[model samples]
Target: MLLLPLHSHGQFQTPLGVAQGQLPQFRAAPPNTPANEPIGGWRILPRLNVVETFSDNVRLQPEALQRSDFVTQINPGLVVTGVGTRYSVNIDYTMNNLIYANLSNFNRIRHQLNAMGTAELIKDFFFVDGRAVMTQQNATLFGAQGVNNINVTGNRQNVNIYNISPYIRYRFQDIATTELRYTRNMVSSSSNALFNSQADAYQASLNSGTAFSTVQWGFNYSHQAVHYERTNRTVEFERSIGNLRYMVTPRFGLTATGGYERNTFLSIRGSPSSPTWTVGFIWEPSQRTSIAFNAGQRFYGDTYSAVATHRTRMTVWDLNYDENITTFNQQAGMSGGFNIGNSLAQLMAAQNPSMSPEAIQQSAQALLGLGLQGSFFDPNNFFSNRLFLQKRLQASVAMNGIRNTFILRGFDMRRKAFSPEGVDSGLIGAGNAALLNNTRQTGVNALWSYRLSQLTRANIDLTYTRFAFLAVDRVDNLGLARVSLVRQLPQLLPNMIGMLEVRHNMRQSNQPGLSYHENAVVGTLSMSF
Candidate 1:
């Protein structure tokens, strides 16, 4: 089990698909609120949005059988935020009602929610964190992907995740700091209920205090047990580690770690219990640049991890690589990966240090409303039921200018099954388990945003992704492009915004019945009070 600190409102990593560049239909803050000052109590904002879309390939079918149609969407939403002495909360919920002109049978309503809260119960010793998320995702990478909930693709499925954690922290007199935490989490899917699961995790850690400046040491332990509803099976993971760090200089350090891990799973190899060890180094020459690299040995085999980051006045660069043994339920419930909204906000804040947090958040939301954000290439974990060994590499750079902003991101991910097949089935049946046994995905995304004026902005986004099934000798390539214009309607209403967008989507594949092309135009009007 990997123990990561839980945040109050961490960003959620979601999968990217064709035509995913559509703008979010909600505003960040109310018009009368002050950007520089924080709110004292809870404030609720209600909003309504109407969208009309026309697509030449509404069904994403081949050119010979393509059809066109109009999709009308009416969405009502709410946003709530609060900050108090000991607690803070944030919530966003939307109910979408869709009506299709030519495909009325496919019309449906969907719900979306993202909420999180944190409270300090004992001043400085005890704290609690909670989060709930309801969203849609593609059920399988082999199926046709939908851009949003409005699409009629059978691949779309609703996913719900809930987590709550409580922890205690204490300090020994000038010696060390200790923390103990317990977490409970649940994950469920509407269409793929066979993969539903619940897990309980416990963790404890102790680290040296300021007394040990040159030589620091730490101890950590974690345990987790997961229960699957369909299989009526339970899996357990336990790990313990002790680490030491010696500062060679003010800016460089050497580190060593030794650990033991045990797990209950059907491994193709021998028993999955082993002693783990790693040697690493950390370098931080300045506040704006840092790098960390580690090489380790685990039950699976050789393991490696690296993280490097650099920041400038107008640009930010990040690179990360890691190999781990994880399950879909754990990744969806706890892992905090790359999120475009949070990345944009960080870039904007870095570029304009004088801007307030609320101002930077609003600016990022405005850019997102103009379809200026690009999705990162995340690993596909939507259809897996067993544990897997995953290795992923990702890098991104963002640059902000007086009149333009640019973001570029690339990723490569590979996965191999560790648990035996046919024991439990995911969305894919046991007969077709080979598709998920060994897989790889590689992709790149680029986005450009230009400020036309104080009230209007233009954006261009491009993305390319490739999926490979190593066992089946199948591969697919998907490409997407979007151009959009957004403007604030202060003359019409103080809280209104309007947008127009055009998109193109195409897919090429070695597998039959998986190739298609689409063109779409969308117009939206949103108002909040």
Candidate 2:
């Protein structure tokens, strides 16, 4: 059946259909404090924000505590426009500091400055767009350890990322649009406590279509180079993605996607390639119900632990219902990946190692536990399909009217694991590490917002997630919970906007106080002309 998800947003007006344009973010903003800027010939926005946070969990739950953080930002941009002058430039500066009161003890100071520019050129109906940004992430954390787990030894990682890219596009008078783009990213985690990596990729593609009746097609080429000395490993990879979308009508659409990737091991690696293909459809039988189906195949190459190749097949289905302007979506699917190869036990026995009889038996047991292994992502997992419900309402407060919004999203999925031989020994190691026999996971996310006034607002966001999976013996379960509260003061003071936020995180496992928790507060003042 054909599916067309009914959306009140007047169809998907994604920016890819329009020229290059975006909003600005501060060059200097305290941690978790956001700075926004406009990218185009038009830049006119007044802004102010403040953020701060404190926590006392350090003594009770080291992992769940945050000592303090503060940030302040200020920025404005210049818009350049004309036939050949469709460019925008924005500049920002930031100052921030933090302290982590713990046995390891931590203190930090940061100063950042940034400049961003975007260009959109239209020549004789042909179009081209590009962006250039430069940033310096500098920080001084007392007594190094560079955010390390241990309390001793000082470690610091400094990174300077420079990004510059330009794309050329061709917009057919009445047919399609094609573009070519290139990007480079690198991070030098030289500090003893951090992981360093480097990567770069390029993409070339074409998109053809219009709403109601249209199609999209493209080919992408990319390369990823990475080195993690801390992990004692390296990987070199190349990947390609190609796909197409066909919209038969306003109420029905079909899409097909195909991709392939190959990775060469620099230190310890496995199969060099993986390929996947998928086709799906969307049908909107009525304004109240939506339906969808997808079928695909995936190959997950085994590197560290695999006796042979592993391939997975996937199938998915989804249904949705709406009433009173409220909508709900649900989905289900099945998928699995597996691989079989020569008996690993034979390989182990073939080797000659000097060891005691008991040691030999233990080693033999580890080999026998491997059996046939499987490794790959199950695309059919229900989590890929979710139900999101949302509504808008108006309210009255303190002599002024306000608007409120509410949203909820949920997902669940179960998957299989590879053989014990293919498992990473880290989590279970000497204690008995083996591939998961089966795994199940479920998650729910919620959001609520209230506009107290034209200049002041409040928001609450929360998420709850649970996990259940296989082990050599019985099933293991885990859960995570997170909550955040935010207050927006666009006019905390004239020409200044401030944002304050606090968050709490809890995880369920044998470990109670090892969960991640953070709190941040920041403020910004901006003046635009």
Candidate 3:
């Protein structure tokens, strides 16, 4: 769901526009643009929020030990954005202070941040990208899951990730183009259960330019070294690949790639290094539809990837399937985080093809402010430090109407650890090693939003997730349903908003002492200046 801008080489580049879909949960979105905004090429907004919540089971514990509590939250936040001919940036930060009426000892403060930007150091050849994210994540899948920071489940931890990359590109007349890039990445966490890691990556690529019409060729090489602080070990990955593309027609192309990979890791199945090969095809029958599929072999076994996207006047559909061997740190740093705003913007753009980008962004922001989007479960990722082979398939459809919007998404993910499990063997200790050995996660989410009036809106969200531990014979099912109403308080103040929500959460587990249910109500008021 993270909105990553694609470059010509089919790689992610730092977006120079607004950061999509990274808004805070359970809060109002950024304020409307004021008349005096963007002073001196910069726009800044300061906001405050007050919230009150009543929950039957604040700790998500079983009925016998459940306790009722009233939670109060006071949050202050800021948003800053700027754009210049040579650079662009976006930053959003919030400080959450939670107070428990009955559980005073649990009062705490949490910081959340999502910032990214890009700059052109040299007009056409040099560029740099920077990003940082601080968010909360479930520490382990075996324990209770909390919907938000209000729950005292003791299963959540703060995770911080940072990345900086700078690259240079040059062209050789009309023959070819080449580029070299270096990236530094860091991942840290507040929990001792997860390891802190740093990585250095170097990459180089050369591709045929417009000189090659029927046949196009490319060569790429990359090397990465990651250091885990917890285990004081360094893992390295190196790859070299050559690829060719044959254009059969204006809308169809055949592709093939041959590569060799080398890695330093303890593998249980076979050698960690192997020769990789893949064959695939890309087809674009129309301007609104595209499909790509590839099948290959790696060290572990066979691998496959498929992507299909189609958009109509009022609807957008996407389906993807991919398999890869990676660690948790790598996934976190590479994908950034999911953004609902970005997804909404895409749907809106598809619905109104003539809308300008700036107008679409504003509309997306307004919809987000009205709480039309809800956080959905991501089955492809979880808390783990060991290296694993993951295969995931996800599909989604979004439809936009004159006064209503609907989104439905589903995903199936499977993971198996290939590295040894132990304190000295891998990133985690043996006690919790089995948790990630073999697992499957499947989930579906549906959201419906209705615009009752220009200033009022309503939303209903439902989600269900099932987690199965293949190695430990444990299965857990979680479900949530929520209904909310949001109103823009122009009468009170142009930049003020109010929301009321009611939700129910339940968990059904085959393991004893893990089943629970809770109902909650939340009211929030937000104002921006």
Off by over 4 Å in 3: 1-37, 337-343, 350-376, 424-431
lDDT of 1 by residue, 211-246 (tens): 998999999999999998867688899999999999
Error of 1 at 273 (Å): 1.6
User: Could you give candidate 2's per-residue lDDT for residues 402-484 as a string of tens digits?
Assistant: 24433344444444432232223432233432323344545554444455544444556565555444443333222222232
> TM-score, each model?
0.90, 0.48, 0.89
Task: Sort every candidate by TM-score, greatest first.
Answer: 1, 3, 2
Tell me the number of clashing residue pairs for each predicted model.
0, 35, 3
Task: Give all candidates' CA lDDT scores.
Answer: 0.74, 0.33, 0.75
In candidate 3 the C-alpha lDDT for residue 213 amounts to 80
Q: What are the RMSD figures for all models against the true structure?
A: 6.2, 20.0, 6.3
